[model samples]
Target: MTQTPALQMTDVTLEYPDGRDGTLRALDDVDFTAEVGTITSLVGPSGSGKSSLLAVAATLLTPTSGSVRINGREVTELTEKHRAGLRRDEVGLIFQQPNLLPSLTALEQLVIVDDLRGKPRRRARERGAEILDHVGLAESCSRRPHELSGGQRQRVNIARALMSEPSVLLVDEPTAALDHERSEEVVTLLCRITRERGTATVMVTHDTDFVPLTDAMVTMRDGVLSASAHRGSPDAGSTRRSDRPGSSPG
Candidate 1:
């Protein structure tokens, strides 16, 4: 049996009003999909619509036209409240910055996610501790952001995102603030967690060195997306453009 993709977008186009009558096209008829237990890296220059794509996938921005389905439910036309619920229930967003609260402990950062969902306090703490441990922060749970290293704080950010047990993970430049070694560690952790948790992860990154660590790579230019080489494919390390929009990697 064929399993449904965890995240899918079809003919998605997004536009913003320029001055008065003009409109800037941010995404142009893009189609994309991320299967369960896989990570798809999105690479492109600034202003190439990578952020726009992530926002749309997160249901934070409504597309001008097209269909966006998360776990097989169409969301483009959902009411604002419904969209918010969908985001809370099905999506996990990891921002470029850890953006941790100044006073909250690392474990508190994750516990707050469940708190917002009205989960029981005891259960929330148990789940938060387990997730922190999974991210290799078992001993740092009580430490504040100031006491943790840069990479450790980022791990807290990732663990917080995972607290909801979301099916789709949208990551935006997760390694931008880390050094080479830390970047490698964080990306490796993301790959491992994605596979273990069966989440479909789409990461937007500028670091080409780590692109091969992901399951597939896709590039965007002028709001157009094209397939790139898959990590383990015969043509790996080479760029390949698709004849049409939204071609699957390799």
Candidate 2:
């Protein structure tokens, strides 16, 4: 049997107000999807609307046209409060910056998330510990963000995103700040989580070095998706791995 896509964007468009009564199209009729239990990487230049696409999918921004669907629900037309609810309950976001609070400990970071959802803090702490361990940060749970390494902090961000059991995980440049080894490790972890948890993951990154690590890759340019690849099939990303620099043999 075939599975439904975890994320689905249909002809989504986003516009920003340009100066003096003009509009800039940040995203132009882009369509994409990430299936559950798979990882899809989005690659693009700095101003290619990658972030705008993510913000729209995450319900942080509304599209000017088209539809945004999560697990087959058309959320583009939802009210602001409903969109916020969808984000809080159905979508998990891993920002480029770890974005941990200075005063909160690693575990507290997640506990606070539950509080925001009107859940009990003690109950959330139990869930937080399990997720912290899942992200390999169980040992650093008590340490504050300032006390952890860059990679550790990123893991904290990942754990916090999953703390709510979201169906779709939206990750932004997770390895942007890490070195080569750390970046590879984080990428590997992301793949493992997607497979193990059966969650649909969309990762946005500039590094072509790790493209092979994902099940598929989509390249965006000038607010449009131009090239794409898929794994285990006749797609650009999987069939032509040897062509990529630093790609290891399967």
Candidate 3:
């Protein structure tokens, strides 16, 4: 039997009004897939449509002409309410910034999701502890965002996203605010957690250092996505260092 991809985008295109009597194509006929228990990274320069691809995948943006399938269910044409439920139940988003609540402690941050889901408070607390421990943030469960280090806060962000037990994870430039060491830690954790939980993860990052850690890496340029390649594949040479400033590419 053939397994369906956890997330799939076919011939996806996105356009924005360009002020004049024209449109700017953000994505052009891109076909992307992320399988269960795998992490796919989209690498490109700024304004390369990587985020647009992510938004479309997360069902946050409907494509101009294409299809988006999440867990084998077509979501492109779903009503807003249905899509919102889909997002809450099946999708997990990790923004570039942690965006954690300053008022809530680390564990409370995760428990809030359970509260919103109407789950029991005890189970929420227990589940929060479990995921935080998995992310190595258990010791900091009582700390607030301001009290934790940047990396610790990002860990909380990751843990919170996992609280929903989502099948699809959409990450936006996860390492944008992290240093080399912390970036490596977070990416490694992501890979491990994705495998352990069988989540299909699509992470957008300009940092080429994340290439080797990815199960597959794809390049996006000028609103077009190049076919992806595994690390051992012949096309692996396409994963090169980014010459952009502040980049210590591998």
Candidate 4:
């Protein structure tokens, strides 16, 4: 039997009321999926509905029609309460901006989410420590956002998202603000974590440089997704010890 996809969107259509009180289809019949331990990249122009797709996949928006499945469970048919639960328990969203509270230390940024979820502060911090350490932020745990570099801040953001142990990860323009070097690092980190944790990751990136790092690349145009493509950049498949950060020799 075929392995079940970690995330699925089938014939999804999302519409909004135009200023003239007419329907505007932001997403039209979009079908997509991200399998376990795989990274899928979405590329498109502005207003091409990439963000909208992310929103739907994240369970932030219900589609006008069609289905969305998370971990093989159809979520589009779920009630808002159930959808909210799925969002909290199963989906990890990495926004374009780190959006970290300057007042909070890098570790605190992650523990707070657990606190909100009612986990005890002590346990939460322990979980935070494990996740941060996984992301190679062990030494910077006490540093605030300003104390860290842009790449480090993004690592915190990525770590925070993974704290939930999510089955699916939805990232929005994660490389929009960083320079080429930082951008590449962040993408590499994403690929590493996705494979390591067996999370199905769907990332929207404008930078084609990140394309080759993904398991598959799908282009979206005018709210529609095309067939699969690959960049074959050696990192396109599963991760290896060589692909791990700090593994390269100077």
- Once fitted onto the true fold, the runs of candidate 4 whose alpha carbons sit more than 4 angstroms away are 231-250
Candidate 4 collision pairs: none
TM-score of 4: 0.90
CA-RMSD of model 4: 8.9
Determine the backbone clash count of candidate 1: 0
Order the candidates by TM-score, highest first: 1, 3, 4, 2
> What is the per-residue lDDT of model 4 for residues 126-152, given as tens digits with 9 covering 90 to 100?
999999999899999999999999899
Among the numbered candidates, top TM-score falls to 1
* Residue pairs that clash (backbone atoms under 3 angstroms), model 1: none
| Better-scoring candidate (lDDT), 1 or 4 | 1
- lDDT of prediction 4: 0.86
What TM-score would every model get versus the actual structure? 0.93, 0.90, 0.91, 0.90
Best by lDDT: 1
Off by over 4 Å in 3: 232-250
Cα lDDT tens digits for candidate 2, 111-167: 999999999888899999999999898899899989999999999999999977988
Task: List the RMSD of every prediction in angstroms.
Answer: 3.5, 6.3, 6.5, 8.9
Question: Candidate 1: where is the Cα deviation over 4 Å?
Answer: 231-242, 245-250
As a whole number from 0 to 100, the lDDT of residue 31 in candidate 3 is: 70
lDDT of 1 by residue, 1-250 (tens): 9888888888788999989899999988887888889888999999999999999999999999989999999998899999999999899999999999989999999888888999998999999999999999999999999999999999999999999899999999999999999999999999999999999998999999998888888888988876665756422112223444475643
TM-score: model 1 vs. ground truth: 0.93
| TM value for model 2 | 0.90
